[model samples]
Target: MTILQPFSKLLKTIEPLWKIHFEPRVPAEELAKSRTAGSIPSFGFFFLLTLASIIATLGLITNSSAVIIGAMIVAPLMNPILSLSFATATGNWALFLRSGLTIVLGSFLAMGVAFLVTVLSPWDVVGSELLSRTRPTMLDLGIAIAAGAAGAFSLTRMSIASSIAGVAIAVALVPPLCVVGIGLAGGSAMTGVFGNFYVTNLDVAGGASLLFLANLIGITISACLVFVLQSYGSLRKALKSLALGLLVALMLSRPLGTSLHEFAVDNRVQLELHGLHRDGRFRDVNLIHRVDTKLVNGVAYVNIFGAANEEFIEDQKNIDNLDQRIFNAIQPMGVHTMHIAIRIAPIEIFEYRNTSSSYSYQP
Candidate 1:
């Protein structure tokens, strides 16, 4: 028996409940026709896509989440993607080709529009919104899968079709592609936040493109599965496409896994820093200006910039003890070797008494 035999049997056991609870309100044939029609690249589709791309690009540049969400609502790209998934599931070659072409053209159109906008605009800085899409992890793949399933399910039930907007926001098809355009347009280099884990010269275009590809592949595979499960298509017919999609997702998992590891390490470093502060080791430090951690050649380097009181600055032994504590704290997290540097500047505090009209240095 195949490895899926047990799961298949379990699904069979619940077949009645599945059908009763999840039957599509729309007929499969009608739904397929609707999706196929929507996939056609009409003038209206391109016009709306262009507007969404412009809005999304501006949002990324300005770091406005609300504007990006507005673009997501306006974007028509999701229809073609869903059509592609349905076509793949049903083994409809003509619909597949049409939807695939629409997707490709729409992608390039959005990218081109974004490129032109970024080139013309004076704002060239890569902001938090743009940087967030650059390094996608497996969690992003999970979100795409869930969103794809939700999107397909909502389409089958007209009452809940409005949820498609939320699904579009969740998967984010256009913004990352717009980021790809901005990156290609030679936006300023991104550093400081995401720079510690990656090299100074990170490939902004490549990373955002990978994110878009991940979302695309993830949605296609998952939406196809949902269609098959809803009895809209035959599993045997969809198997080949599903296998190919899985293979691509597998290939993508490598880099995504590495990014996830880096994210985890960064979180751990922050947690350790907070732990030190709570444990009183950082009591003398007034504020932590920045913390940067880099892993290179099997060694980890940590740099901390902070402002501290004069007592911490004057006492060499205290600084040495704190350094040893930080090193010890991070060593247990699987680092081969570690180098730490803490730069601190002295800070002074002042207090004034209104009644006495006098000011005193509180140190």
Candidate 2:
């Protein structure tokens, strides 16, 4: 009667011979205990990782999907992660530690090399492509969880391991981290390093990078649950742990995330207000969500396209004042930490003119 069992039943009906197991190789609570004991990578592992990083960097630069997929396949970043999940579920702390380290080291190394390559690559700075990888969401976390489960299932069942790996690679693990590092190397060092760019007096931050980490945690937890569900046969215990973990995350994520965001925005505002604070052109403010998470020239930019008016423009005295005010508004939310480009333009409202005034000039 479990929520997932129905889907399992459906799969069995569709393909009676499908080797779906109700229990996984390990239980859930143990997965939480998994850790990475520092271990050196085998020569082969590093070699593949290096190559994959190179290819992924090229793909990022070219903004090519094909190339990116290719790199994902070669990267093989998900195995150790999957192994870590297994180790976690099984209460094998030593294996879990080893696997965790493998994932961290592999992911970081790939990203670092990718950062250098991207910095030197001949490519236009495509913020969207970069931005896409930066922010993760609830949905993304769902994908990670499912992917982890499927991956564990496939590997343990001796099923289509290759296909599962392919799927997991495509889903992502290394590329986003690589992009975060590359964002810094590609002249976004200031914001990228701290993870935000604020140029104007007002802006916000903490949009995407945190989301990426959220997704990672989601996937890890989901995989842990799946491992327990499919392998341990102790559904009661696994459910208990899974429920507790999720409750904790749910309780902690929003406030913690919001506080972090505010801190970032405040930092950005402080930076801008340091030099220019007198006649800044800004006043009452509301943050536009779209351009709130991007960086250019080592500063966060907020888009005031919809908020600008002649008051901030015509009043020369409001330049520094406006900047300060605007900064104050969003600084608490990191509106300046990301892509908070504030453009000064008159608010244009289309007025429907009555034809009666024109009097048919052209007969």
Candidate 3:
């Protein structure tokens, strides 16, 4: 106890910086009312969550990012999560359980709505937006933590609460759950390629659920920390929930780390390909048409497509030598096991003829 005196005094001195405008910004009574309102089991909450789920599901199905962002804005899911953090901070058991139950029920309700909509719709294709949420990285966790802190701080300042819409955009609480439903609706395996730790044989729904779980835990933990700093509750009271959140984050770290590493490898491979394009060795093939790289189960799969003049595409030896050079280039970058497939197709350069206004190919 005697050893902790200096630290205790130090914390008291720096509490203002941590609070970010401090208490009495919103009175205790009004704050309690806000939290209670969030925790209430109301028809409005369900309506908003269900509607948001439907919109997000359709948005993901159509690969529309704007629609998904709109869904994020309309989601009521953030309020209950914020309330959960507040309950944990204050050691309010009834409020904690009530908020938790609301979150769980809301998640399932969203999923149910998504599943029903997916089943009714004929277009079951998995779009890029849907695939993105199926993979979560440390970057996503970082965003959720920052957004949670911003959200909690906003809640205490009535004037700033309206800006919480931006927090909804940052945290992304609803889309993942809706993705889970879409995955389940298809009943097929959804594979995500990362480094050696790629996920296969798992359905999309299961993969998306992992992302949702990560976001939920990240937001809850960060919100609790912010509330504690604001003098809303004792750190001791929120320990168990915080511990659980940290444990989940720790468990998620392995896959998230693998994804980050894979992303780096992907970028490096693209840069090397760009260097090859700039070297002018391709005989008038000045542009790289497409480069696709996927790392799966310790192997990198590279598909390179280029457009060139007919003469350039006709050289069999050049194609073979170029393939060997690409293989050699990536090898120096620590990519030992990779398969590079190159496809060169003729690009017809068109010019309008003045005589007949007809288009003719040049070279």
Candidate 4:
């Protein structure tokens, strides 16, 4: 009934049209052969991934990009995330659950192992990599959704996996969890990132974890659609599978669902901002950029960047009362407390003298 259903139907027609030529969705058996190869996690690889996750956590806590990247390479998590999509496509519930549990349990394993190392180790600082995970917003959701699609598509085509692996890292599951444990270990203010504030470790951890889930969910959606198209199953079966999978995906994305609601509201806020900007009461200014939405205590804390500072300020003395100006801009939104990352340059002061009819000037 919806536009999307019809569009999906139209795409399905292409499969029937081309079904004569394409190879049957590679038999599920061939794929499983590789499973046994990785069955007994060699002590070396196990310790390597475990050790790497720990070092990466340490790197994140120290805000070290280089260190964190090293951890990503050593991370064996990507295989499971991809395997999750693979198993979902084939309707192999065993593999699906196996991969899913591998990811979930592996994540816990990585975090626990990393925490033990951090707890015992000497360094005791929480860095930016740790700080970055403390918020979940539209942006983080978007990244995961996009990456999920990419991962599924790449799997379908079997092309360029290293790049896809990098993207898996970018969704960045391991690092943020490491950061969360570090925050707990340090007993830092968890408000913004995780507990209640904008950039708390919880915020970042929840957001990043949600992002990972979104990627997995997104990949599954794409995989399901592809399976349906490829005669992965009959229409009735596909629909049932899709419905069931979507239901589960939705549950995994509770934080993402809230963000979507906030984002819809944020969109309306943008529509109103145009009128605010056009009125020129904002001082003939133009916007530079703005973070249209953010999360704080599970609500939106949106910001818009505009070019004019004077629109919000009248004189040098006004700088002293900047809080009032910020309050006035945000008061209408019922924002209890908001932070403005505004940029301004002080106006140069000069006294002028008019000397003649032609008005020769001096300062």
Candidate 5:
């Protein structure tokens, strides 16, 4: 049999527990009607979608987590996505078309609204919120899968309907669309900006799009799995659709894997720097204000910014001595080549006495 046969057998063995935790709470007819009702397109749905997109775009531009969460709570896109998976699981062609169109059109509408906002807004800086969406790893995929499963499970139990808000926040549908809008609108203007750091909006948009697609596919497939397990749909059809979703997720894993590696490298670089600071006599020197790492031509470059005693700044020999130590600290990491640039700010120390105050300087 297939590699999954053993797992399937295991699931069958725990069928009773699965029913208690995940079985459908509503009748099949009621669930089908609910999905159909949610799939129907209307002006109200589009209006809410547009509003949520605008709010989410603003939130991302301003780096406001609260505003972004608010947008997530208001987003109507989740229903259509769930319905699409449900339709596929049930082999309902009409419902599938209805939900699919809702998702496609709604996504475009959200992106269009975000684009218009970006074109008109004076803010040119890409904030942390926007940048976070541009990088998706396997961790993000896992979150989406878990969120999707939780979302599907929540829907079946009316007592847990309130938990959908948490799912919305976890999956984060609108913000990525907003990032796409910002990327599309910024175009060439996105280069060499404060937050952008010479990365083009097109590149940012592509990454964000991949993230959004991963979330979409992950949610759809996971929800399909839940529906099948709950016995709400055609098991054969659900398995087929689940296979397609898994294939798409597999394709996405390549990039996500690369991103994960990059993330690990960055973390390792930071950890190495932290260890150096802790072990060395560099306690008087603050190297943690800002640290930037960039890789070019197979060599890693690090830029550290912090303040030091003014005396340290004035003595070129002493500064050179410290620089050598910094280099030595990073050498053990096994990087073939690395360049470290240090930016030191002078600090003035003031001593207050009974009569007069004395000042000392260090960099």
Candidate 6:
């Protein structure tokens, strides 16, 4: 009894501040009702989801970020996801089941729609925007978590409700799933060759599906935390759900961490290669057309395509020296073994003197 007195007094002191600041502006019951209604599968919901999926698929095919953003704004997928998070927080078994089913149904519907669109379209192009979603890193998890928190917080305050669109765009719930369908429909077995190294054909659908799963798990966990913090649900009740989410997130982090490492290494290699181009040794190089870096079995393989003066292009010794310099530049970055391939196109200049005032042509 004596030990409990201090804790009781501390709670009394903190209760007012908690209610004033941390408590949600909207009533918990009201918010739950709203989310429950939104989670129901209706014509409107499927219609918007279908349109959003088609738009997203087309945007990905065309490599238009702006169009993709528009699809994100129009997507109705976020609501069901938020509903699921709310269900987890409040321990509403009925809402939980409903939201889960809705999410699954909506996901497949969007994928089907995207697949159909991709199949019917005349253009069979896979753009960078689409491929970018295939390799998700821990960085994507962080974004999903942050977006989930922001989305939950905004829902509790009506004034900031409009920001949910931005949250949708940030997390990108539909685009990745659409990419899955697009990958299944039009994706081909493609190989990336860098110098002597090459990557096997990638499973585009599998990678994009993993990205969607990551986003789903990340958003659910973070939103549940936000809901509990805002007093919309009890932490004790949400513990089991949160625990399961954490378990999945932990499993996901392993692959995501590996991907993050690869991305960092690739970026480092690209920067080093770019630095080589700016150095005095490559002064004759006019412009770098492209630089591609790939890591295979702990070895870095770099491919460089650039335009250089005729003199530099013809000099075998200078080219060999440049290759050696590239190896030296990237060696310190923990890359013990590397292969480099350089393709330089000569930049030829032709000058014609117009000595005659009037032009005359004889055929």
- In terms of TM-score, the best-performing candidate is 1
Off by over 4 Å in 2: 1-40, 122-124, 187-212, 233-252, 255-363
Off by over 4 Å in 6: 1-24, 189-202, 284-297, 301-334, 339-363
lDDT of 4 by residue, 139-172 (tens): 6656766666665445444335356666656667
lDDT of 5: 0.80
Most accurate candidate by lDDT: 1
What C-alpha lDDT values do all the predictions have?
Answer: 0.84, 0.57, 0.80, 0.57, 0.80, 0.83
Candidate 6 TM-score versus the reference: 0.81
> Per-residue lDDT for 1-363 in model 3, tens only?
699999999999999788886545677667777888998769999999999999999999888999999999999999999999999888888989999999999999999999899899886566668878876778888888899899999988777888899999998889999998888886764443322123345457766887787788788889889888888888999998788878989998877766665666656656766766688676466456546565666677777666677777787877777767666766654567878776665777777767856787999
Q: Root-mean-square deviation of each candidate, in angstroms? A: 6.4, 11.1, 7.2, 9.0, 7.1, 7.4
RMSD of 1: 6.4
CA shift at 8, candidate 3, in angstroms? 21
- lDDT-best of 2 and 3: 3
Per-residue C-alpha lDDT of model 6 across residues 59-159, encoded as one tens digit per residue: 98788999999999999999999999999999997888999999999999989998898788886555668778988889999999999999998999977
State candidate 1's TM-score. Answer: 0.81
Instruction: Write one digit per residue (lDDT tens) for candidate 2, span 210-284.
Output: 554655566667667767766643445445545655775686476445544544554455445433333342332
- Each candidate: how many clashes? 0, 51, 0, 20, 7, 0
lDDT of 1 by residue, 228-270 (tens): 8988888898888889999999999988876676566666766
Q: What's the CA RMSD of model 3 in angstroms?
A: 7.2
- For candidate 5, the clash count comes to 7
Ranking by lDDT: 1, 6, 3, 5, 4, 2
